[model samples]
Target: MRRFRHFTSSDSTSEINISPLIDVVFILLIFFIVTTVFVDEAGVEVNKPRAASSEDLEKNAILIAVTANGRVYQGGRNIGVGGVRSVIAALLEGDEEMPVIIQGDADANHGTIVKVIDAAKIAGAKSVSLATVK
Candidate 1:
Protein backbone atom coordinates (compact mmCIF):
# COMPACT_ATOMS: atom_id res chain seq x y z
CA MET A 1 0.00 0.00 0.00
CA ARG A 2 1.01 3.57 -0.80
CA ARG A 3 0.44 6.60 1.46
CA PHE A 4 -2.00 9.23 0.20
CA ARG A 5 -1.46 13.00 0.37
CA HIS A 6 -3.92 15.87 -0.06
CA PHE A 7 -3.31 18.46 -2.81
CA THR A 8 -5.24 21.48 -4.09
CA SER A 9 -5.06 23.34 -7.41
CA SER A 10 -5.44 26.77 -5.77
CA ASP A 11 -3.25 27.93 -2.92
CA SER A 12 -4.87 30.00 -0.13
CA THR A 13 -3.04 32.46 2.13
CA SER A 14 -4.44 34.33 5.14
CA GLU A 15 -2.98 37.82 4.71
CA ILE A 16 -4.59 41.26 4.74
CA ASN A 17 -3.86 43.75 1.96
CA ILE A 18 -3.00 46.95 3.80
CA SER A 19 -1.18 48.66 0.95
CA PRO A 20 -4.28 50.65 -0.13
CA LEU A 21 -5.02 51.67 3.48
CA ILE A 22 -1.51 52.93 3.97
CA ASP A 23 -1.66 54.80 0.67
CA VAL A 24 -4.91 56.48 1.75
CA VAL A 25 -3.40 57.52 5.07
CA PHE A 26 -0.42 59.04 3.32
CA ILE A 27 -2.69 60.87 0.89
CA LEU A 28 -4.76 62.34 3.70
CA LEU A 29 -1.63 63.40 5.49
CA ILE A 30 -0.32 65.12 2.37
CA PHE A 31 -3.64 66.86 1.82
CA PHE A 32 -3.71 68.19 5.35
CA ILE A 33 -0.12 69.35 5.15
CA VAL A 34 -0.77 71.14 1.88
CA THR A 35 -3.95 72.80 3.13
CA THR A 36 -2.60 73.96 6.46
CA VAL A 37 -1.64 77.60 6.75
CA PHE A 38 0.92 78.79 9.27
CA VAL A 39 1.53 82.20 10.69
CA ASP A 40 2.99 84.45 8.03
CA GLU A 41 6.13 86.32 8.99
CA ALA A 42 6.61 90.00 8.24
CA GLY A 43 9.75 88.97 6.28
CA VAL A 44 11.70 92.04 7.39
CA GLU A 45 14.76 92.41 9.54
CA VAL A 46 13.63 93.86 12.87
CA ASN A 47 15.27 94.66 16.17
CA LYS A 48 12.41 94.18 18.58
CA PRO A 49 12.51 95.80 21.99
CA ARG A 50 13.37 93.51 24.88
CA ALA A 51 11.18 93.15 27.92
CA ALA A 52 11.39 90.83 30.86
CA SER A 53 7.62 90.77 30.89
CA SER A 54 7.16 89.96 27.24
CA GLU A 55 4.42 87.54 26.36
CA ASP A 56 3.53 85.38 23.36
CA LEU A 57 0.82 86.51 21.03
CA GLU A 58 -1.76 84.35 19.37
CA LYS A 59 -1.08 83.48 15.75
CA ASN A 60 -2.76 84.92 12.63
CA ALA A 61 -2.13 88.63 13.04
CA ILE A 62 -1.50 91.32 10.47
CA LEU A 63 2.15 92.11 11.13
CA ILE A 64 3.47 95.60 10.53
CA ALA A 65 6.92 96.94 11.25
CA VAL A 66 8.70 100.23 11.81
CA THR A 67 12.39 100.22 11.06
CA ALA A 68 15.12 102.22 12.74
CA ASN A 69 15.32 104.44 9.66
CA GLY A 70 11.70 105.57 10.04
CA ARG A 71 10.52 103.27 7.28
CA VAL A 72 7.12 101.71 7.75
CA TYR A 73 6.37 98.20 6.47
CA GLN A 74 3.35 95.97 6.18
CA GLY A 75 4.17 92.38 5.35
CA GLY A 76 7.57 93.57 4.14
CA ARG A 77 6.19 96.20 1.80
CA ASN A 78 7.33 99.77 2.21
CA ILE A 79 4.09 101.49 3.03
CA GLY A 80 5.18 105.03 3.68
CA VAL A 81 3.93 106.82 6.77
CA GLY A 82 1.30 108.57 4.69
CA GLY A 83 0.21 105.28 3.17
CA VAL A 84 -0.37 103.31 6.35
CA ARG A 85 -3.97 104.37 6.70
CA SER A 86 -5.00 103.40 3.18
CA VAL A 87 -3.04 100.17 3.11
CA ILE A 88 -4.19 99.05 6.52
CA ALA A 89 -7.73 100.13 5.80
CA ALA A 90 -7.76 98.01 2.66
CA LEU A 91 -6.41 95.07 4.61
CA LEU A 92 -9.13 95.43 7.26
CA GLU A 93 -11.95 96.20 4.88
CA GLY A 94 -13.74 92.86 5.06
CA ASP A 95 -12.03 91.27 8.05
CA GLU A 96 -13.42 92.73 11.23
CA GLU A 97 -11.45 90.66 13.73
CA MET A 98 -8.04 90.71 12.10
CA PRO A 99 -5.76 92.01 14.79
CA VAL A 100 -2.89 94.33 13.98
CA ILE A 101 0.56 94.09 15.55
CA ILE A 102 3.38 96.55 15.09
CA GLN A 103 6.90 95.21 15.52
CA GLY A 104 9.03 98.28 16.03
CA ASP A 105 12.77 98.11 15.92
CA ALA A 106 14.42 99.02 19.20
CA ASP A 107 16.20 101.91 17.52
CA ALA A 108 13.09 102.98 15.62
CA ASN A 109 11.73 106.41 16.35
CA HIS A 110 9.10 106.42 19.06
CA GLY A 111 7.06 108.92 17.11
CA THR A 112 7.06 106.59 14.12
CA ILE A 113 5.78 103.70 16.19
CA VAL A 114 3.09 105.93 17.65
CA LYS A 115 2.06 107.05 14.22
CA VAL A 116 1.86 103.48 13.01
CA ILE A 117 -0.22 102.50 16.00
CA ASP A 118 -2.55 105.39 15.40
CA ALA A 119 -2.91 104.45 11.77
CA ALA A 120 -3.82 100.90 12.71
CA LYS A 121 -6.48 102.22 14.99
CA ILE A 122 -7.79 104.48 12.29
CA ALA A 123 -8.05 101.45 10.03
CA GLY A 124 -10.66 99.99 12.38
CA ALA A 125 -8.38 97.51 14.06
CA LYS A 126 -10.06 96.95 17.40
CA SER A 127 -7.12 95.01 18.81
CA VAL A 128 -3.70 96.54 18.17
CA SER A 129 -0.53 95.42 19.89
CA LEU A 130 3.23 96.02 19.90
CA ALA A 131 5.77 93.23 19.46
CA THR A 132 8.72 92.78 21.81
CA VAL A 133 11.26 90.18 22.70
CA LYS A 134 12.18 88.71 26.03
Candidate 2:
Protein backbone atom coordinates (compact mmCIF):
# COMPACT_ATOMS: atom_id res chain seq x y z
CA MET A 1 0.00 0.00 0.00
CA ARG A 2 1.28 3.55 -0.84
CA ARG A 3 -0.02 7.00 0.24
CA PHE A 4 0.55 10.23 -1.72
CA ARG A 5 -0.14 13.79 -0.43
CA HIS A 6 -0.26 17.09 -2.40
CA PHE A 7 0.15 20.46 -0.61
CA THR A 8 -0.15 23.99 -1.97
CA SER A 9 1.31 26.95 -0.09
CA SER A 10 -0.82 30.11 0.03
CA ASP A 11 2.32 32.23 -0.35
CA SER A 12 3.10 30.54 -3.68
CA THR A 13 -0.25 31.57 -5.12
CA SER A 14 -0.19 35.15 -3.78
CA GLU A 15 0.51 37.74 -6.51
CA ILE A 16 1.75 41.27 -6.07
CA ASN A 17 -0.91 43.84 -6.92
CA ILE A 18 0.74 46.15 -9.45
CA SER A 19 -2.28 48.28 -10.28
CA PRO A 20 -1.20 50.89 -7.74
CA LEU A 21 2.32 50.86 -9.13
CA ILE A 22 1.02 51.41 -12.65
CA ASP A 23 -1.12 54.27 -11.42
CA VAL A 24 1.88 55.82 -9.72
CA VAL A 25 3.91 55.54 -12.89
CA PHE A 26 1.17 57.16 -14.93
CA ILE A 27 0.91 60.01 -12.41
CA LEU A 28 4.61 60.67 -12.60
CA LEU A 29 4.48 60.65 -16.39
CA ILE A 30 1.70 63.21 -16.37
CA PHE A 31 3.56 65.37 -13.89
CA PHE A 32 6.66 65.45 -16.07
CA ILE A 33 4.63 66.18 -19.17
CA VAL A 34 2.84 69.05 -17.49
CA THR A 35 5.94 70.64 -16.00
CA THR A 36 8.26 70.16 -18.91
CA VAL A 37 9.57 73.32 -20.52
CA PHE A 38 9.94 73.11 -24.26
CA VAL A 39 12.33 75.32 -26.17
CA ASP A 40 11.55 76.73 -29.60
CA GLU A 41 14.38 75.78 -31.91
CA ALA A 42 15.67 77.68 -34.92
CA GLY A 43 15.33 75.53 -38.01
CA VAL A 44 18.89 76.10 -39.24
CA GLU A 45 22.24 75.62 -37.59
CA VAL A 46 24.70 78.50 -37.58
CA ASN A 47 28.20 79.24 -36.43
CA LYS A 48 27.30 81.61 -33.62
CA PRO A 49 29.68 84.46 -32.94
CA ARG A 50 31.58 84.54 -29.68
CA ALA A 51 30.80 87.10 -27.05
CA ALA A 52 32.59 88.17 -23.92
CA SER A 53 29.36 89.15 -22.15
CA SER A 54 26.91 86.63 -23.44
CA GLU A 55 24.58 85.59 -20.67
CA ASP A 56 21.85 82.97 -20.40
CA LEU A 57 18.44 84.02 -21.61
CA GLU A 58 15.05 82.47 -21.10
CA LYS A 59 14.62 78.97 -22.46
CA ASN A 60 11.34 79.55 -24.27
CA ALA A 61 11.91 82.10 -26.98
CA ILE A 62 11.46 82.77 -30.66
CA LEU A 63 14.68 81.50 -32.26
CA ILE A 64 15.58 83.00 -35.63
CA ALA A 65 18.72 82.01 -37.47
CA VAL A 66 20.91 83.92 -39.91
CA THR A 67 23.14 81.79 -42.07
CA ALA A 68 26.55 82.71 -43.48
CA ASN A 69 24.93 83.17 -46.87
CA GLY A 70 22.60 85.86 -45.46
CA ARG A 71 19.57 83.59 -45.31
CA VAL A 72 17.20 83.86 -42.38
CA TYR A 73 15.56 80.79 -40.89
CA GLN A 74 12.93 80.01 -38.30
CA GLY A 75 11.72 76.61 -37.26
CA GLY A 76 13.83 75.07 -40.00
CA ARG A 77 12.26 77.09 -42.82
CA ASN A 78 13.80 79.98 -44.68
CA ILE A 79 11.73 82.90 -43.45
CA GLY A 80 14.05 85.49 -44.87
CA VAL A 81 14.13 89.08 -43.57
CA GLY A 82 10.59 89.88 -44.65
CA GLY A 83 9.10 86.80 -42.98
CA VAL A 84 10.71 87.52 -39.64
CA ARG A 85 8.02 89.94 -38.51
CA SER A 86 5.05 87.75 -39.33
CA VAL A 87 6.66 84.70 -37.82
CA ILE A 88 7.51 86.46 -34.60
CA ALA A 89 4.13 88.11 -34.40
CA ALA A 90 2.28 84.80 -34.75
CA LEU A 91 4.49 83.16 -32.12
CA LEU A 92 3.99 86.00 -29.66
CA GLU A 93 0.25 86.20 -30.02
CA GLY A 94 -0.45 84.87 -26.53
CA ASP A 95 2.71 85.92 -24.72
CA GLU A 96 3.77 89.50 -25.23
CA GLU A 97 6.85 89.03 -23.04
CA MET A 98 8.27 86.29 -25.22
CA PRO A 99 11.82 87.11 -26.20
CA VAL A 100 13.35 86.93 -29.65
CA ILE A 101 16.81 85.41 -29.89
CA ILE A 102 18.71 85.79 -33.12
CA GLN A 103 21.39 83.18 -33.79
CA GLY A 104 23.60 84.77 -36.41
CA ASP A 105 26.45 82.93 -38.06
CA ALA A 106 29.89 84.41 -37.64
CA ASP A 107 30.16 84.93 -41.37
CA ALA A 108 26.63 86.29 -41.77
CA ASN A 109 26.35 89.86 -42.88
CA HIS A 110 25.86 92.27 -40.00
CA GLY A 111 23.21 94.12 -41.96
CA THR A 112 21.14 90.98 -42.39
CA ILE A 113 21.30 90.29 -38.69
CA VAL A 114 20.23 93.83 -37.97
CA LYS A 115 17.27 93.48 -40.27
CA VAL A 116 16.13 90.37 -38.44
CA ILE A 117 16.34 92.16 -35.14
CA ASP A 118 14.39 95.10 -36.45
CA ALA A 119 11.71 92.79 -37.78
CA ALA A 120 11.39 91.01 -34.46
CA LYS A 121 11.05 94.28 -32.62
CA ILE A 122 8.43 95.45 -35.06
CA ALA A 123 6.51 92.25 -34.35
CA GLY A 124 6.00 93.57 -30.79
CA ALA A 125 8.53 91.49 -28.99
CA LYS A 126 9.51 93.20 -25.76
CA SER A 127 12.92 91.58 -25.37
CA VAL A 128 15.12 90.97 -28.41
CA SER A 129 18.55 89.43 -27.87
CA LEU A 130 21.38 88.08 -29.97
CA ALA A 131 22.50 84.53 -29.29
CA THR A 132 26.25 84.17 -29.07
CA VAL A 133 28.67 81.57 -27.88
CA LYS A 134 30.53 82.43 -24.74
Candidate 3:
Protein backbone atom coordinates (compact mmCIF):
# COMPACT_ATOMS: atom_id res chain seq x y z
CA MET A 1 0.00 0.00 0.00
CA ARG A 2 2.87 2.35 0.70
CA ARG A 3 4.40 1.69 -2.70
CA PHE A 4 1.04 2.26 -4.43
CA ARG A 5 0.56 5.53 -2.55
CA HIS A 6 4.01 6.70 -3.55
CA PHE A 7 3.29 5.92 -7.23
CA THR A 8 -0.02 7.81 -7.01
CA SER A 9 1.46 10.83 -5.11
CA SER A 10 0.78 14.23 -6.69
CA ASP A 11 4.28 15.39 -5.64
CA SER A 12 5.93 12.91 -8.01
CA THR A 13 6.95 14.33 -11.39
CA SER A 14 5.56 12.07 -14.14
CA GLU A 15 6.04 14.32 -17.21
CA ILE A 16 8.42 12.99 -19.87
CA ASN A 17 11.16 15.46 -20.85
CA ILE A 18 11.26 15.71 -24.68
CA SER A 19 13.77 18.52 -25.10
CA PRO A 20 16.63 16.07 -25.73
CA LEU A 21 14.61 14.12 -28.22
CA ILE A 22 13.71 17.33 -30.08
CA ASP A 23 17.35 18.39 -30.10
CA VAL A 24 18.37 15.02 -31.57
CA VAL A 25 15.69 15.24 -34.25
CA PHE A 26 16.81 18.74 -35.20
CA ILE A 27 20.41 17.61 -35.49
CA LEU A 28 19.45 14.72 -37.74
CA LEU A 29 17.41 17.08 -39.92
CA ILE A 30 20.35 19.43 -40.33
CA PHE A 31 22.69 16.55 -41.14
CA PHE A 32 20.40 15.31 -43.89
CA ILE A 33 20.01 18.79 -45.33
CA VAL A 34 23.76 19.23 -45.48
CA THR A 35 24.43 15.84 -47.06
CA THR A 36 21.64 15.86 -49.61
CA VAL A 37 22.65 15.91 -53.28
CA PHE A 38 20.25 17.28 -55.87
CA VAL A 39 20.50 15.79 -59.36
CA ASP A 40 20.66 18.34 -62.15
CA GLU A 41 19.27 17.15 -65.45
CA ALA A 42 19.99 18.37 -68.94
CA GLY A 43 17.21 20.42 -70.53
CA VAL A 44 15.80 17.63 -72.64
CA GLU A 45 13.93 14.64 -71.28
CA VAL A 46 14.57 11.25 -72.81
CA ASN A 47 12.92 7.90 -72.48
CA LYS A 48 16.00 5.97 -71.48
CA PRO A 49 16.27 2.40 -72.63
CA ARG A 50 16.10 -0.40 -70.12
CA ALA A 51 19.24 -2.36 -69.43
CA ALA A 52 19.71 -5.08 -66.84
CA SER A 53 23.33 -4.08 -66.32
CA SER A 54 22.68 -0.43 -65.59
CA GLU A 55 24.33 0.85 -62.43
CA ASP A 56 24.16 3.95 -60.25
CA LEU A 57 26.44 6.84 -61.13
CA GLU A 58 28.02 9.62 -59.11
CA LYS A 59 25.71 12.55 -58.49
CA ASN A 60 28.31 15.10 -59.54
CA ALA A 61 28.68 13.86 -63.08
CA ILE A 62 27.54 16.05 -65.97
CA LEU A 63 24.29 15.00 -67.62
CA ILE A 64 23.86 15.16 -71.40
CA ALA A 65 20.63 14.26 -73.11
CA VAL A 66 19.83 13.37 -76.72
CA THR A 67 16.21 13.74 -77.70
CA ALA A 68 14.39 11.44 -80.07
CA ASN A 69 14.95 14.04 -82.78
CA GLY A 70 18.73 13.78 -82.25
CA ARG A 71 19.13 17.19 -80.70
CA VAL A 72 21.45 17.40 -77.72
CA TYR A 73 21.02 19.38 -74.50
CA GLN A 74 23.34 20.12 -71.59
CA GLY A 75 22.73 22.17 -68.48
CA GLY A 76 19.38 23.27 -69.86
CA ARG A 77 20.95 24.53 -73.07
CA ASN A 78 20.82 23.19 -76.59
CA ILE A 79 24.41 22.18 -77.16
CA GLY A 80 25.22 19.93 -80.06
CA VAL A 81 28.13 17.50 -80.25
CA GLY A 82 30.45 20.38 -81.13
CA GLY A 83 29.33 22.24 -78.05
CA VAL A 84 29.77 19.07 -76.03
CA ARG A 85 33.43 18.94 -76.98
CA SER A 86 33.99 22.57 -76.06
CA VAL A 87 31.98 22.43 -72.85
CA ILE A 88 33.56 19.20 -71.73
CA ALA A 89 36.99 20.55 -72.50
CA ALA A 90 36.34 23.56 -70.28
CA LEU A 91 34.94 21.34 -67.53
CA LEU A 92 37.84 18.91 -67.79
CA GLU A 93 40.24 21.82 -67.45
CA GLY A 94 38.85 22.43 -63.98
CA ASP A 95 38.54 18.73 -62.98
CA GLU A 96 39.98 16.19 -65.35
CA GLU A 97 38.55 13.31 -63.35
CA MET A 98 34.96 14.47 -63.86
CA PRO A 99 32.72 11.85 -65.47
CA VAL A 100 30.19 12.42 -68.26
CA ILE A 101 26.89 10.62 -68.62
CA ILE A 102 24.78 10.54 -71.79
CA GLN A 103 21.01 10.11 -71.63
CA GLY A 104 19.73 8.87 -74.99
CA ASP A 105 16.12 8.30 -75.82
CA ALA A 106 15.13 4.72 -76.56
CA ASP A 107 14.22 5.64 -80.13
CA ALA A 108 17.14 8.03 -80.67
CA ASN A 109 19.62 7.24 -83.42
CA HIS A 110 22.60 5.11 -82.45
CA GLY A 111 24.91 7.33 -84.45
CA THR A 112 24.08 10.27 -82.19
CA ILE A 113 25.08 8.35 -79.10
CA VAL A 114 28.37 7.36 -80.68
CA LYS A 115 28.99 10.93 -81.73
CA VAL A 116 28.41 12.25 -78.20
CA ILE A 117 30.71 9.60 -76.75
CA ASP A 118 33.36 10.45 -79.27
CA ALA A 119 33.04 14.14 -78.52
CA ALA A 120 33.38 13.48 -74.81
CA LYS A 121 36.49 11.39 -75.41
CA ILE A 122 37.97 14.05 -77.63
CA ALA A 123 37.42 16.57 -74.84
CA GLY A 124 39.66 14.50 -72.53
CA ALA A 125 36.87 12.91 -70.54
CA LYS A 126 38.41 9.84 -68.96
CA SER A 127 35.07 8.39 -67.97
CA VAL A 128 31.98 8.46 -70.21
CA SER A 129 28.92 6.36 -69.50
CA LEU A 130 25.57 5.83 -71.16
CA ALA A 131 22.59 6.37 -68.88
CA THR A 132 19.90 3.72 -68.97
CA VAL A 133 17.08 2.60 -66.75
CA LYS A 134 17.05 -0.80 -65.12
Q: Best candidate, lDDT-wise?
A: 2
| Candidate 2 C-alpha lDDT tens digits along 1-134 | 89888887767676899999999999999999999998768978899989999999746888999999999999999988999999899999989988899999999999999999999999999999999999
User: What TM-score do all the candidates reach, one by one?
Assistant: 0.77, 0.87, 0.71
Model 1 agreement with the true structure over 5-100: per-residue lDDT tens digits: 978757686799999999999999999999987886676889998888877776578888888999988777898788888887887877878888
- Top candidate on TM-score is 2
Error of 3 at 69 (Å): 0.3
lDDT of each: 0.86, 0.92, 0.89
Could you tell me which residue pairs clash in candidate 3?
none
Q: Sorted by TM-score, highest first, which candidate order results?
A: 2, 1, 3
Candidate 3 has its poorest 10 consecutive residues by lDDT at: 1-10
TM-score of 2: 0.87
Across residues 54-96, which tens digit of lDDT does each residue of candidate 3 receive? 8897558888999999899998999987799998898778778
